[model samples]
Target: MRTALRRRLLPAAAVFLLAALPACSSSSSDSGSGSGSDAAKATESGWSFTDDLGKTVKLDKAPTRIAGVNDQIVPLMNYGLEPVASWGYSSIKDDARFDDLDTSGVKQVGTAYGEIDLEELAAQRPDVIVSEVYPTDEKGTIDESQPDYGFKDLDQQKQIEAIAPVITIKLGGDGADVVERTTEFAEALGADAKTVAEAKERYETASAALTKAAKDNPVTVTSLYADTDGVSVAKAEDDPALNLYAGLGVKFFEPKPKGYYWGNYSWENAGQIGGDMWLLQQAGYDTAQLKKQPTVADDAALAAGQVHPWVSAALDYVSQADYMEQLAGWITDTKPLDD
Candidate 1:
């Protein structure tokens, strides 16, 4: 069974629109019937996409009035294709995913925990909606019942689809893959090549610098999430953020129990898994409260002020680059407490 913490940790939205959708509806299915001529015409006209679901979403022209989920909006903006509207797990101001973004112009269709404003979203009249898709099978079958990135709940999904074609890229891959796929989607939507190229260059530079810094400093890092229930250490192989950090040369503390993305621990046992630095997942919780947790306070890294913000869902290139720079700076600025 997937842990509740897994769902809570991700920025992706949940499905809550089952009552509104037909029992046997295929609204979000990839089996839309389109003629061969239509496919040829789409290729000639300029915009077409075979999403992760194998569904072909076509446009007469590149979409200018775009709508996206919170995590997706930032990347679209970075590629110079800002969405006209967006919905997210929190208000624009509160979501760290969009800290560097200027979302003043983009209309907020909904905020926090999959609550979407159908009327407002309809008002946007978007040509297409973009979001991240999670694959359910080895053959790339996506779970279409739920919208990704906290855009809409199950009941509101079909309603949102009625307003626009929902295009999605697969989620849960390496950070580099996420950047490449997101850029490809943006490019298809008419994002400026120069802007995308610049973002990619920035990411590459930051990643290289981070890798080099880790090599020189060699600090052991651990990623964790703490709540009232307990604390959990994230597995590097299972989490994209942790994997990215590991790829950049930071060594992570391995948990005793294997095969799961996160290992649950009581507050008292959190310090057993030692590290020179700790990355605390900061989503859906108060950082101040987290700092005050007995487990966190007891950890050597946390007590020594070696704790850093770990935005697990920062999939976009610009955010990833910024995070890389932050980690690199931390590595260079502080000496290992264990040393």
Candidate 2:
């Protein structure tokens, strides 16, 4: 009777041990699965973004020390992302493009064209660099040889990149598209969402008003930049300001063949590009000097004061809205030119 009892107890113990072995194996599998999930979350939370160049930039954490080109800085600021340092362009004072920006605490990395103070920029210890990338080919490749907004030329690009990751936004999109992309970039940098939303709302409202005004008073408009040497008639579709005007119902003057951004015309024949009104690119020439030119002075639109300021590179929505409002007011105030 004792031998039979021992045999039954031994079999029961073996069965219990087998059951415990499966439970331990299941626990190990669950632990491994949990570790993989944690790693995925860690990757998701890390700082990583794909720039316009299609390069993925990564950092240990979200960047705080940011730098940008002057033209790029104002838009970032409008979205509530302030930069620590900026290069390209000059002081915002008296510049219409930067009229809405405040650059009080930001350090100027470079003030002149094709010049960057690398020592000054490096001293800022920027976590990231922001700028506009202009495409050179149909494949949308950046022209590294050409000067970008943040750096004067490609010569200092490596040094700048060595300091921090460079994030570039493509510059050729329309006004609304640009605003959307800029908002996305700013949000990625931890800008206040509510503030960016408010700004976007304001822009849309202003844009609607301008469109209505433009529809009410339809007219032909042309954009030109003139100097003593020659005049460059802007390709309306290529320039942001002119594109906005075209979107608002104004008929743009298209040059013959219609591919290039600017059609170069001698000062003698500048007036031949006919339009009911003219939008002047107000750089490298003064108002008085422009008015003094025979071709510009003799043009019916110029003579009638139907000329408005056009910033080809205007980026910020507020600045674009302000410019559109001014254009709308001009359209409302002036009589359409006789055909």
Clashing pairs in 1: 13-150, 16-154, 16-155, 17-154, 17-155, 89-112
Predicted candidate 1 versus true structure: per-residue lDDT over 1-339, tens digit per residue: 134345434443443332332111113335542323332133555566656555676666666788877777888887767688997767888887677677777999878656777667767767788766554433434566666645546656666776777776666546566666676677777778788778889989999999999999888887777777666787776665566778778788887755457777776776577778877777534457766866666656767888787674456677788889998998876567764
Candidate 2 lDDT score relative to the true structure = 0.63
By TM-score, the best candidate is 1
Per lDDT, the best of the predicted structures is 1
TM-score for all models, in order of appearance? 0.82, 0.81
Candidate 2, 35-102: lDDT as tens digits: 11231122555666666555556666777778877667777777777789886645456444556567
Q: Where in model 1 is the C-alpha error above 4 Å? A: 1-42, 135-153, 284-296
Instruction: Itemize residue pairs with steric clashes in candidate 2.
Output: none
How displaced is residue 132 in candidate 1, in Å? 1.8
In model 1, how large is the Cα lDDT of residue 288? 70
- Error of model 2, residue 172, in angstroms: 0.9
